[model samples]
Target: MSSGPRDDDVLRWYVGVPIGTNPLILMDFATVLVLVWAFAITAVVLLQLFFGHSLTGEHIQAAARLATRLVLLAAAGFAIISFLLLRNRYTALYRLDREGLYCENMRMGWGEGGLGELSKSFHWRPFAVPPLRDPAKSVTKKVPWRLVDKVLPLEGTRTLLFKSGRGTAARVYCPDDGTFERALRFARAHIPEDARSGPEKELQQS
Candidate 1:
């Protein structure tokens, strides 16, 4: 049986994901904002150039102004909804030693001022029609080495899955090469033999 990290030498890994990593999120905010604002500005300018010299077009001018405001408002509303739907990923911290394993999910949030701190203040639209669960984010967890039932290495996804005897589990997604190898190594060294899921064994061979 292989032993885990020493008490005096715990192994640690950290992962931070940026909002711009996914192009879908970027497109959601960027495309809508650009298209809506551009259309509204263009419409207003065209109306002024075409009818500004007219003396009896007060009603037409008022209607154009109102339409521009409505378009801008609709665009802003959609952008806000997209922001709430596509919340950012949380930071992940993993610690493993001879005794146990610990995984923490740190969310990014506005600090007291504008420092952008991490906190539990991650409040999205709870009643969203599509229900945004933010699968990339994880909740905090701690488990003893013995209580761990299995460790599965997801290759294509570059993630590690830790299942516990108490039915609790944690999934760590690797954003880069460093985190993926470190997590796989930690799971192999610490997890018990009987708890090796099929994929985990393949990871060991490779």
Candidate 2:
């Protein structure tokens, strides 16, 4: 029986994830403030323009003002539901080693585009619907390494994606943060000496 390390076995560890940051928690406040401020500023400017003209058309002015406020509110509301909350479910970490690629989904998030796939509903209504389902973007579904080749990390989110090396491909997405970090540390610890980089190389030199 082969006793040493096989060319395709990987070691993984589960590291704990830090609590969600305060800034992340406070994003709701930030969004509300920005929206309120933007609307207020626009209202002030429009008021100045309308009044300066000495045209006392209250009905027209009220309609235009209501339209502006409704538009702004809709934009801000969609931003919160679609991005702030849903996108958080899309982060993950990826580790590549000689024993094949290892992908761990351990991040927090919900909707697509953030770390998930933009949904069919979101296709026509980008701002109205959360990213729901897409076969190509489903790269974080945990699977054995023998099936993956390329892995893409979502920008600004913790989601990591995996795919067939080339040609026809399958995809996976990982959104778990704590477990993925731990697995990455473990993979780094066991990666072959020849394939190690950064501090890994330095450690071997010592």
Candidate 3:
């Protein structure tokens, strides 16, 4: 919400599920546990069938081995996936300023601190594949306000669609009604006059 023109302007809002913050991430971890539990139970059931009522130490040991292996594999898979997801979320930063909207993809550098610093670096790698470095490629965009086409209100957030030929868009969660209204006002003010009139006319008629 800090709108200052300083070197470190605070982002007004964020879009994606934050690292270690969204409950959905916990649900994903729970899924891994459930899968491991199901595999262990199935293994135990199979062992019970083979051993019948005369279940012995060897049968228990076999089931234990199967369950341990399954649990280890599931945990390893979950950890790798969660690491990539959190890394991507932690590095993304989108903001709207007086001049325009901006998005930056960054990499972590020495001497940085906190989550804010983490946003400086891009960390997503599909299956841990490193991205090819391109010196000519830009990691940030500062789109002018007039180039924005529409500001659509969503449940708990808003999406701004760009009029640029590329069809780019940015989504931001509005923590409260006041913030939402302010974002809408800024978006409306920047939209072209002809583009704004059509929506207004339709609303009045309805």
* TM-score winner: 1
Question: What are the lDDT scores of the predictions, listed in order?
Answer: 0.55, 0.41, 0.50
- Candidate that beats the other on lDDT, 1 or 2, i.e. the better one: 1
Per-residue accuracy of model 2 over 116-194 as CA lDDT, tens digit each: 4433212210011222323223334334445543344343334333434443232222234443343334344454444
Error of 3 at 68 (Å): 28
Q: Please give, for residues 139-159, the per-residue lDDT of candidate 1 as tens digits.
A: 777878777777766665556
Scored against the true structure, residue 63 in model 1 reaches a CA lDDT of: 55
Model 1: lDDT equals 0.55
Give candidate 1 misplaced runs (Cα > 4 Å).
1-9, 17-82, 111-139, 165-168, 197-206
Q: How close is candidate 3 to the true structure, as a TM-score?
A: 0.39
Worst 10 residues of 3 by lDDT: 123-132
Task: At residue 186, give the lDDT of candidate 3.
Answer: 58
**Which pairs in model 1 have colliding backbones?**
none
The parts of candidate 3 lying over 4 Å away from their true place are 1-88, 91-98, 105-138, 157-166, 173-177, 200-206
Our model 2 lands, by Cα RMSD against the true structure, at 13.5
Query: What tens digits encode model 3's per-residue C-alpha lDDT throughout 96-198?
Result: 6667777654443233342234552243210111222321223676777676655555533233344444455554444345555565565566556565557
